[model samples]
Every structure is written in structure tokens, then in C-alpha cells.
Target: MNSSEIIPSLEQSLITTDRDCIQLGSEEVATILVNLKSEEGEIIEEGGADVLIYAEGIEISETEDNKDGSYRAFISGAREINEARVGFRLDGKPSTKLITIRVQERCPEPFIDFERTQLIAEPPEILNDGKDYSTLLLQLYDREGRLLDDKTPVSLMANSGILSSTVFDAEQRLFTAFFRSRRVGEVGVYVSVRNVRYPVTIGEVRVVDPEPPEEEFSIIPYESHTMLQSSSLYLQAAGSPGIDSTKGIHLRWMLRGALGELHLPKGNLAEPNQTFNRSEDYVKIYRAKYSKVSFTLNLNRERPAVIDHANRLWIYRKEETREIYLYFRNAAKYDSLISNMSADINHSNFIALYHPELLEFECKDDLFLKLV
Candidate 1:
């Protein structure tokens, strides 16, 4: 009979048995018989072909050629599998059609593989102590519960900190990269994988100051005069600066012996004259010494006033009334928002009487959340 016809005949009349001629049980040892063939409808002779078998969870014990265009194989396994295949090569040519088999039998345990494997960081947050770094662990897995051998390079980047190495050897997936703090902001670490279009942020680190002390300084009034006088008033920094880039001290300008309190819209140290711009729609200054002016230094908004200073005043009668605006700004003098009101001392629609207004605002450094 031809190879195709012989295979079907042998399969129909095949007998299954163990070494003791007993029927095989579920997940137990089994001996199977397979007919070998060539592509030209000819039977493969003994020692004329090399056979191969592929089973996901099964182990092959042994195989023997029957010398009559047939082969026998012994295999044992306890894992449930859906499909298996048998292949052979004859006359220096591999078989195009492989023998497929169904291995649907009761298994002791089911096999599973990881999906969308990822690399992760242990203890995602770390102190900026400059000595210890986070450990990067590879979570890749296979159905066999073995570590997959991979050699692809992984790329790394940081927004604000320093990384010891940028390229990682994926084969030795478990590794540690040293990190150094460069500034007082949040640090983010990113990783790029092969075939991935965008990089992923894996972890973050926060660098903080170790219990900063309270700021000590004084606000020096260089020049002072009444609203009627053309002479200008200026406040300068006398000692070490009281504010940093991330925070600022509050300076409350007050007025006594006046119909309404004085409002210094811009108490800028660099340009004291801009604080008294009279043409602006906002009330830069209130009615003269008849409207008096003073200032109170506040190191902390939660605490009481630290220092207070007042300027001597005289009355002045002006032609028209000017507007006043309460301007909000950050430590870097960035204009945030402004509120306008009529400068009329009687009405004082928007101006609060002797109320503490904030001129220099505190804000967080933008570099903290910046992406590389």
C-alpha cells in the first residue's frame, strides 16, 4: 500500500498498551506507534529517516524504528496539552506535512505563561541619600516556569537625577543602577523597550531638604515720604535674603491717621518706584499722610508679625483720584493675577481696611514633575 493509505490502515488497527499490556490511564505512560513516509507516496525504510517530536509538557522516554516503515515512541507527562506534532526527514528533505495529534487527557496541573511581561522596580521610592539605589527586577516568564533567555538592550532615562548606566543588558535582567540627586525636586525614571513606540515611567524619587531652619533678616526702608511729597520711598534687603526660589516671606503694608489704609500694589525690591505707579487703574498709594503709610514684615503666615515699620506723613490735595489693584506674584516676580478697585478713600469698594494682603506668593519648583 502507498504511504498515505498505510498510515490510515495502521492507525485504525493500532493497539494501545503499557509495558504490562494494560490500557494507559490519564496522564500515565503511553506507547504510541507511528508510520513513517516520504513526500513521493513511498514508505521510509529503516535507518532512512530521522524523527522528531514536539510536546509542550510531555517528556519523551525512548523511540525505536520497526524497520518496516513504522516507528514506536514512549512518552510520559502530567501536564494538559491541546496539540502535539511528529516530524521526520528522509533523503535530505524534510517532510512538508507533519503528523498532528490531540493530547486531550486529564492532567494533574494546568500550565500557564505570562502575558505582556514587564520590568519593575523594587521599593519604588528612595531617599536622596546618594548611596543606595533601587533594584530593577525583570518579571519575564515562560510556560515552563523557567527564566526566558533574552539579550535585547533596555534604555533608561531620568528627568532630574543622575543614572549610573543608561543601557542595560536584558540577559542579566536583575541589576542595580546608582542614582545621584541633582536638585530639590521629584525624580522620575523611564524605560524604553524594543518595538515600543513610547517610553514608560517606572518609578519616582523625592529629594527633600533635611529640616530647614527658620529664615532671619530685616526689611530696611532706604527712602520714605508722604503721598504729597515728590520724594520716593524704597525698602531694601539689609541682611541675608529672607526668601528662596520655592518660598517667599510676606510683607504687609499698613496705614494709620488716614481715611483709608495705604496699598502698595508692588513692593518690589529691584524697582521701588514701580510700586508707586500713580497712572495705573489700581490704587498704588492711598490719600497722603492725612493718609499715613506703614509696613509689617511677616516671616511666616501661620505665625504672628515679626517686625513693623511706619512712615511719617503730611496731607496733600490732588486733582483726580487714581485706581488701585492688588497684584499677586510668585517669588520670581511672575505676574499671576490682579484685582482692581476705586481709590476713593470714602467708598474704598475693593480695598480691605488694614487687612493683610499677599504680595509675594510661594510656589513649587516646576522641575519636580518635568519629563526628560
Candidate 2:
């Protein structure tokens, strides 16, 4: 109270006369000014004050009193992007109005920080299917933990049985690498800056064979049929070369009758139910109830013929004899939904026109058939 009653108070503040922001790597002088006012509402000549400064990500090299209720702060060596506050108090009274100083990067040096790098795979694993692919994401940064603004080219190398391509998005500071596995094995991926001596391994991808089908089981026909006709039929079967654990199996029933041509269902013929085999390994049994059979006649043409089933039953005349074919394959699932293989079924016995239709067909490779 005694000092407040005798001395004037400091009011109105300004930094660098008008500027409040400074760029990094700059040797700039910032000045703070305040007006000393007397209790009688008059400007004071002999005003005394103590100045204080607070700053982050930057250093305040020096501070000087202007001897007229003002102060000057020297700013240098900005370590990061941040702001600083400067203020003063007159005659040990309350502090005057504060001024802000913003420090920004002047020049950016772009590079990859392998120590703090992050990598992510969309599906997290690769399958043996040639078409089953995964997306790899990478975020790049500089030595100072700051995101690099400029686009940087990165080189990528992979171990055996893997294919990849790199792409960078400058606006988002994100890099994406598309990868596809050729075989089932452990694949290592690495990245490096141009001209850098050693490359760092981004991650290791485990390439696994597409799950094999369960062993051949039994196909149980719930309904008896000697003379094929338009009728509701229920059937169930158990077997192996089984469905994939993660990706279920694609099952379809094809029937060719004496009167009607080859018949294929619109969707999957059987729904897989979990079952245990004699060896205690988990297996799947497929079952379905068909109200009616739909058939499409295969045309004799050089190119593969496409059949359009208009969601109707292709019924056969009463007393007509028919042959049934059961087909099962693998499927792929992801973050969104499952992408099923093409519905077209290929037979190895292309020349045999009247042989018993192959119930369980196995392909040497992962790609069974492509869905149109």
C-alpha cells in the first residue's frame, strides 16, 4: 500500500513496437513498453519496474531495463515451435499487460526418423492367394520430432515371396506401400533414405498358406429321390480339405437333370456348421434345404459362356433322371466384408462329359477360380 500510494502504476504494453511473432534461427530483438501513470492521472517521469519473461521451446538470452518503465528481451536459438510471454511490474506493484512472441521454423530439414517410426498393415497378415493383398502405412518425421512437410522418396526392399510398391502423400505426411505375398513364408521389409548406408527393417510379414480344406467326410441326403422331379430336398455332408478358420468356405450344389441342362444355385448351397473330427481337430459340415433346383444350359462356344440365373427355380419334368455335383472352396475376409471368389467352377476332367462329377476338387495353387 505504501509503494502503491507513492509510485505510479504501469499500464499499456507493446512488443517490438508492433511485431509479436518471430521466426526460428533468427537473432531478433524484442522490446516491451509500458506507460507509468500516477494516482492523480498524470504520466510519471521517474518510473521503476522489474521485468520477467516466460517462454517455451526457445531461450531468452538477455533482458534489460529501459530506465523509463520499459524493458527489452533478446530472443535467440528457437529449439521448437512455440510461444513466449513478456511482462513487467512497476515499483513492485502488479504486473503490467503481457506481450506474446511466437517462434516458428524458418527452414525445414526433412528426413526419416527410424527410431520413432510407425508402421501398420491393414489386414495385419498376408495369405497365399496371389490376389489377396495388404496395405502398409508409414509415418515419417525429422530429427527434432517434427513432421516433415516436404515429400521424400523412400526405397523399399523385401525378403523372398513378397511384392511391394511405395507411394507418398505429401499433404498428409503419410506413406503407403502395397504388398502382395507370392508364397507362404516369413518375409522381411526394409526402408532407407537415398544414399544412406544402412536400411532399417520396417516390419516382418508372416505369409501363411491359405487354410486347407478339411478331410473328405460324408454327404448325407436327408430326402430320398429315385426319379428326379420338382420337389423340396434336404441334404447335409461332412468332410475335409476343410474350410479356412478365418475365411469360411464357398459351397455350391450343381444338379443336371435328364430334361433340364446343368443347374447352379444363385448363392452358397450349404451353411457351414462347426464340428470336431475323429482326430479332435475342428472341422465344418455343410447343410442346405433346396426348395427347387435352378439349371442353365451350357452353350457350345469358343469363349467361356456366362449364365444369368434370374432368381427362379429351374424345375425338371417328373420321372427325369439327374446327377448332382458338390463344390467347396475358400474365401477371404477383412476389416469391412468378405470378398468371395468367382462363382465359375472349373473341372479338371474337361473332356469327360458323362463321368461322375468330381465332388471335392483341389488346385495345386492358392488361386482356385476367379469370380466374375
Best by lDDT: 2
Model 1, which residues run further than 4 Å from truth? 1-123, 127-132, 138-150, 166-175, 194-197, 213-372
TM-score of each: 0.22, 0.29
The superposed Cα distance between candidate 1 and the true structure at residue 7, in angstroms, equals 73
- lDDT for 65 in candidate 2 is 61
* Residue-level lDDT tens digits of model 1 in 100-124: 3345533223221334345465555
- Off by more than 4 A, model 2: 1-111, 214-372
Q: Backbone clash tally for model 2?
A: 12
Encode model 2's per-residue lDDT on 1-372: one tens digit a residue: 122343553442222322355566676544434434433322233334554544444566455665654455566556567777755544455454455666776533434577887777777787867567677777766687876433544534453332444567776677776666556776666654431212367776677877644322223333333233222232223244455423444454333232113122223333343221223322245557645434442322222233122311112222234322223211111111112222234322221331342223222212223221
lDDT of every model, 2 decimals: 0.37, 0.45
